[model samples]
Target: MPTDPQAYRPATALLTLGEGFFDPVAPADFPETHLRFRNQRAAAEIGVDPLTDEEWIRHFGRFDPLPDTLPAPLALRYHGHQFRSYNPDIGDGRGFTFAQLHDASGRLMDLGTKGSGTTPYSRSGDGRLTLKGGVREILATEMLQALNVPTSRTLSLIESGEALARGDEPSPTRSAVLVRLSHSHVRIGTFQRLAYEQDESAMRRLIGYVLHNLYGEDGDDPIRLLDLVVARTATLAARYMAAGFVHGVLNSDNINVTGESFDYGPWRFAPTWDPAFTAAYFDYQGLYAFGRQPEAIHWDVMQLAVSLRLLVDTEPLIAALDRFAPLYGEAVTQAILWRLGVMPGDPDADRSLVQAVERALRDTEVPIDRFFFDAFGGRLPDAYGTGWTEVRDALAGRTARGERVHPYWSGAPCSMLIDEVEAIWARIDQDDDWSALDAKVAAIRAMGDALA
Candidate 1:
């Protein structure tokens, strides 16, 4: 961690794209501020992990710009389709991209906020996040990262000391502001807004910016861009399935251009292999259910393809879009094998094994997360009981990488069930005792280290 804040060079890479892209906005403070969490692992990217707790709170809590950060945060402009219906007015209502810095790996990272304050897009609702909501997102990101899902990390969370009323859960809920470390905040909705405006020049400029920065274009055309994004989206979709997760909202706006998952609202890990299992309680139609996630993500990618048409032709875009199904098919098998701790030398055989595993999980109705944590890092036939004998034999005669399971796995499986998460938070809510939350975080980190 760098001691000098001056060493932190914030890059306004997206801002350089110019007008209609984003608007300068200031973070409005709350009644009070108390830093709740800081992500040291993510902070080491920009070399600020060793800052004193007071210093961390001052910068993130006060919304103070890091040295050479953006003169002011930018509330990005974008439009998106919600549940397949186009909504042209939505953008960053409660959050803004605060700063950008290249990590040790030379990958550009963004420090973005949620519940910092209101903006032009704040419609009618208060531009605030519930403290409970903040805690939930923290847990969501931590668990997803532990499970090896490509996701954003919560860098900081602060209780904003505001009592807010809401209809979704209990009223007079505590409020908070959260900061996330992500590769980029640019989304598919960014392009959709430009397309809606019929600003073809802006569309081309945005595409060029994305290709030059994130996609690493080499004399590539829009077709190549579409193909790249399609592949990434397919890979991410497969990982989500293997992780047994359902991102309740896969709206176009929520689909990151980097194809990394973020914005973890109304998300859940499946307790079983049920296709119709939905995460968001408000999702009455089962639109973004666990099993339908692949379909939803593919549909979102289609929106990105449609936006690209403002700069390119129809034929190549269609061809690129066609790659989703096969790419997803191949990805799912690889993901399952990765979770099961095996190398796939034979594609046909590995696929058959995955199919058998899925059939077994469905027929036996085994708890989803427990099954993986217990079976992770290929085990021998004698290690399992008769109940798992079929699964063991099917995975027999296959090369399995060893040294995966830990001493902790021998007891109870490491799990992040909803009930457990709520119980952890309940302790904090009732007595401001954070020991449970801290213990859970430590355990999850240990699980990730063992898996690695």
Candidate 2:
């Protein structure tokens, strides 16, 4: 890991696409800075893991655009469906794509910020992020990554030394700035905004840019793009189910074009198999509930298909949209075995094993997370429950035997339960103690490393 933050000058690849996609923006000045977290693993991607905390604040907190990074931060513009309603006045209101750099594998990665400052899209809101919100997102991404979900990583989080009054969770919450590293910041809403404005030319350009830069396809064949995105989205939905995560908002703006999950806001990992479990408090209708996620995602993809109509014929796009259900089903079946640490020997047998596992867990009322932790590597506990006989028989085909799993799995599983999260924050708020938060993150990362 390089010790200096300025070692790599990112390509700022998105800037090459041109004027209509984004607007230049700067970060808000904070009263003080305390570097809270730095993802060393993520830093190794761009070779900046060795930077000192002071250097971290200088580059990430001071809002000094690195001379080698993006020339200037750009607040991307896009519109989206908010709660299934068309909202044209939405964009990067509180954050911007700070820079883009190539990872060790040569995939272009974006360094984006949240709670940076106000922009043209900040209609009536203060563009500040609560410290609690920052902590929540860090946990969300870490837990999702541990469960093998395609997601972003929190690169840096710094307390901005400002207390803010907010109506949501708590008043006078501390403020923060968060940096996340992801494959792309371009969203489905990007196309929606272009289509809504009747900018077919920009739409075509954007499509080609996404395909070429992100997908490694040279030409803008919109049909092929649709199929790729559809397949990825299907697997994405399956990943969420296997992980028991409810991604509060399935809006077009929150759905990345790359289909990797990011922009976490009231995300939660289900403690049980409750389908109607909703993550966000305001989702009264349960539209984006755990069970409705697949439906909501399919609907969002249709809107994306609608935008692609400007360039491609309707039949092919429709055909791509039709693949989601089957693909999602197949992916979930395979993911079940993967999570169980089995090699998935036979397709039909794998499906049967998954069905058996689900039936057993649902019948016994065993927590989904606990089942996975206990039965990891195909080891069933000696003590049998109501469904263990069948579960044991089904797992017999699991040829999983001795394998190297981290010691963390042998102990109590680290969970992202909301009560536990609130307790961690309570210590910080009441006694200014940060050890609990630090230990939680460390345990989460250890689990992720074991999964890898």
Candidate 3:
């Protein structure tokens, strides 16, 4: 806590990057251009005051020579498992945490930037983000919040007037910087890096830091830290399942050790419930698929436990790892039940509904957004149009599948709200009226609130 809660203050000191905390190479790639947004509005929501333009420049901005900033970045050097493979080297490739601030909400928030420039960890690529990626992240963060998912919020988006090149698209493309708000950017791999180096002292220090910064000092026992993190990971995994989200990449490097959801790369929501639904085109094996998320998280936690063993009792660590499965299962079941908005009527009906969802994913290939929208919301009338009719009819047909019909009929009242909204969307599309569309969306959103 600060003496003056309302006043914004500069960081007490600068944290410069070093070999001990990061790799020893420049970023493999750099953003050709850069842009910035205040995101002060978002900061305020979490109880942090925005810096004035001068303040931002004085504290965070490095607007001087091209690829500015002295690269005095530090406070990184965490390790994580990339796609289940132990990767000993990884940390702050293009960005670094400048400071950690205590928000008005009493939450400690990390102020970090992406596309700021390159560092030793840059590897063989430019450390920059495309404008499109920035925009998509903004939309994803906003939608995730609306849907009540635990995620890093986009604090700001800025464009640097530079050109860059990349394999996925083109070179010298426009660049943008994104500020991500999260509990901590620390990942499971952070510990892995130290463990791999045989640096037991550093690993112990890292565990101490995590316990103090994330879990708090009162409960700072290293054994308890392992237990808490494992349980938290399980809970988060369940939350993802409940919300129909698929984090395309669940590698150790991307799994935040703080237990807050971070590293939003090619993430998506389940259209139906296909176990293999994945957002990343490159995730060929579906290692991070929709259904495998829980398992991936479990694996990540196990990695964390193994790393933490340098400082804690091995038995307690193993015991913590063992708790993940049952906890995750209980959480998933509860989340699904709540999502269906059911009363405690028939146990078979709940079972049938889940089975029906699983079958729907296998039966057809449809847009994930449309599938959830139609099923959770409602079906559009035929007058709605091509996509609307398709979704409406699909839900109607899905309801007739064996024992599933019992819950389908019971859920109609809950589902009708979605159906009516789809009808309104169809009306708007037919009319090509923006104002009408906005008004209808507002009404539908209000209805969702009432239903919620």
Please tell me which model should have the higher lDDT, number 2 or number 3: 2
Query: Compared with the true structure, what per-residue lDDT tens digits does model 2 show for residues 229-317?
Result: 89888888988988889999999999987889999898888887778889989999999998789889889999999988877789989
Cα lDDT for residue 333, candidate 3: 56
Candidate 2 runs further than 4 Å off: 1-9, 401-405
Candidate 3 lDDT at 122 equals 68
Q: lDDT score, residue 131, model 3? A: 60
TM-score to native of every candidate shown = 0.95, 0.96, 0.72
lDDT leader: 2
When sorted by lDDT, best at the front, the candidate numbers are 2, 1, 3
- State how far residue 362 of model 3 sits from its true place (Å): 5.8
lDDT of 1 by residue, 74-156 (tens): 89999999999999999999999888887777677889998989998989968899888888888888888887788999999
| lDDT (0 to 1) per candidate | 0.83, 0.85, 0.60
